[model samples]
Target: MSLHEILFIVFSTVVLLFSLMTVLSRRILRSATYLLLVLVATAGIYLWLQYEFMAAVQVALYAGGIVVIIVFSILLTHHIHHRSKPFPPVRVITGLGVAGLGAALTIWAILQHDFHYHEAEPLEVNAKVIGQHLVNTGDGGYALPFEVISVLLLAVLVGAIVVAKKDKANEQTSENK
Candidate 1:
């Protein structure tokens, strides 16, 4: 097999393994870490596919920035280590059944389509072209999304800090009393 094919296989395997671990892990922190691994592996796949810009965005935004923020927020909470165990099995089984059915439907749809089975167009890798298309989308300028994303992240940061501080304040007041 070619080097690209080998790397692709490895990336896919790692992504799948970590994704499963993310779902199956009992510890919240461990599950978040596994989720980080999955995101990083997905970025690797984007890199292997020669989407350098997309790969960098995946690493910077999802893997590095977003995951760190989420993990830290959980860590910063009041004794997340003592979080109650996950809920009972009825809802869990229902959710899993829905997920399995969705996956099967998605697979069936893919089988019915001519998706990637034939190469109709060549993929390009130029920042200039992408930037132009992003702005030309009229309604969805890429720059607009970037600003929106920043605002959303900022909101998450502020919300997490407020929650952490509230618990700290409550603890102090109770201790004083």
Candidate 2:
């Protein structure tokens, strides 16, 4: 097989394996670590596709920023060695059924679609073009959704802090009594 095909297979396998590990892990910290692996493998796939900007964003924003925030939140709110309780059989069966249905639908859609592949001149991908696209409010602009996601992340951080503080306060109250 060609090098490109080999690398794609490797990256895809890593992503799939780590994704399952992330979900099935009982320890919250381990789950977060597995998620980081999944994100990094996804970045590898982006790099293989020659989307350098997307790969950088995947590594920097998702692997670096989001995972760090998740780990920090876990550290603040729970013991380092905390393990999640086993999911009930009903939930497990439901989750598997949904996953199977989604996979089947995706395969069906892919089979039904006719993809036309044509070689075209590559567009210049630079920081300036990316920055403009990000800030532009016109067609294909991500400005609004970007701002919304930032606000949502801020809210999540604030909520984590509030929960941690409440836990500490309860602990102090119990000690005093």
Candidate 3:
């Protein structure tokens, strides 16, 4: 009916389709690309909610940064299973059962609760307030989480380096053999 409603429908459909594709596709590269599409569709939904900053962050971080890194990791690691051994049967069944249980729990919780919306005061997204919050000593400050995230990034970088080196070593050993 409305543009917003149409956008919501489109984004929701795209996300669902891409997510299904991400799971169903056998190829690692294709699955990664589909997952990227799903993230982009989620970003579009964030934009529809008027969270432009969050939407941009989702696209840049998930699609551009994380997804690229993931694809690269897959390429470099080369641990992707071929069609003959896509996954172990027991692991696949366990994952599906867990996923089904989680879905059932979420649906039950939704059915049990009656949710109502209340409009809250919007926070200012100005640079000055954001800067203060980023480095402030108060409860509203996000400095701790920000610092922790930097540590996480460093860990990820180190892990990526280790994985890459391991892959290279395996390749060299196989070649030598």
TM-score versus the correct structure, for each prediction: 0.77, 0.86, 0.80
Which of the two, 1 or 2, has more lDDT? Answer: 2
> Candidate 1 lDDT, tens digit per residue, 1-177?
999899999999999899988887777778889999999999999999777878888888888887888778777774657545786899899989999999999999989997465555875849887778677636535777677778978987887788778888899999999
Report the error of model 2 at residue 131, Å: 5.0
Best by TM-score: 2
Report the poorest 10 consecutive residues by lDDT, candidate 2.
Answer: 140-149
Q: Report every candidate's CA lDDT.
A: 0.82, 0.88, 0.84
Off by over 4 Å in 3: 77-84, 137-140
Task: Encode model 2's per-residue lDDT on 25-140: one tens digit a residue.
Answer: 89989999999999999999999988887798789878887888888878887666988899999999999999999999999999999999988897787999888889988886
Ranking by lDDT: 2, 3, 1
How well does model 2 score by local distance difference test? Answer: 0.88
Please give the TM-score that candidate 1 achieves against the real structure: 0.77
Q: Find the candidate with the highest lDDT and give its number.
A: 2
